[model samples]
Target: MSESEQLMVVDSTGQPLYPATRKKIHQEGLWHETFHCFVINHEEGHVILQQRAKQKKDFPGLIDITAAGHLLAGETPRDGIRELEEEIGLVRQFEQLFPLGVFLEELILGDLKDRERVHLFLTDESMPLERYVLQTEEVSRLIALPFSEFARLTDETAETFQTADQEIIHRDQFVPHPSAYFRRVNEGIQAYRVQQT
Candidate 1:
């Protein structure tokens, strides 16, 4: 399995554990931390979304937010920004992102147990899709959808969004708009709007 396929365990405060014991540690709930990126195209008023590869251990073939990963031990949320570069070749400083706050999310999907204290952030400007170098086994395809349309679809009943090649799925089962994940994003968007005024 690739880095994306590997499981990472962190303490409740988001500290990474030794690689060998991570799987079992995660089960024990010693630590937990996840980073979610909502990359938006402010100029276009759209958000970049990725279609996870069918081979993913969880939520395979689902459309998800722009980028996400676990914050390794001893790493700050800003360090996660660096992980994004490792996963997708994005290189930027912390100032470019707007901290959207954090939320605790717990879910049981199939046999896997997920308990994450997720850190959310938003960037209205992101590197172009064409410039992205995807970790293919992890990501099958990418799409730039209007933010307003995403809000609309969340209200609709579509299953998920599939990529042009059909190798990746971009629908709700993988990532839902009304979900806690989206709720935080909405909060960030609202906060951003407030700051603008």
Candidate 2:
């Protein structure tokens, strides 16, 4: 199988085990490592989110992280920077990203055991939404919302997010990631926002 069709299965602690087809991993709920990056626009008090292409096999049309993907066999988390370029047409140095620590996210999407040891990261990029050259095959568009507005979704205080452009995004539109993952992501961006200021 191709890189997109296969994943590097890892133990719960994120140590590599072996290569497995993405199907098997999902079927078995096996632990796998994934790289997730969140783009922070501190100047605008916004966090960028990607709208997954409707063609996506999983979570079609859902709002997701800025850039993210599975770590194929023989790949390390650092190499995940490629996802940014491939998905959003943004070139970045690995060092430009701030580590938010590894997190475990578990979800059952109709028998798809989406268990991931997420290598989470945050990067401050104050670019305009129009600057992103989205790969329409993976991402339909980019949305930027203020940090507090996005936080309300995870904290379950709000049902929707209004983008900087004034577009309305319902909470259910986001991928059903575990609450802990969203919490950590929020905290990471908040701290980085302060530093950038």
The numbered model that scores best in TM-score is 2
lDDT of 2 by residue, 136-193 (tens): 9999999988888878767766677799899998889999887778889988887887
Q: After superposition, how far is residue 92 of candidate 1 from its true place, in Å?
A: 1.2
Worst 10 residues of 1 by lDDT: 161-170
Clashes (candidate 2): 0
Q: Please give, for residues 107-135, the per-residue lDDT of candidate 1 as tens digits.
A: 65555466777888887664677888888
Q: 142 in model 2: Cα distance from truth in Å?
A: 0.4
Question: Residue 187 in candidate 1 has what lDDT?
Answer: 64
Give RMSD (Å) of candidate 1 vs. truth. 4.4
Candidate 2 stretches with Cα past 4 Å from truth are 1-4
Candidate 2's displacement at residue 157, Å, is 4.4
lDDT (0 to 1) per candidate: 0.67, 0.88
TM-score of each: 0.76, 0.95
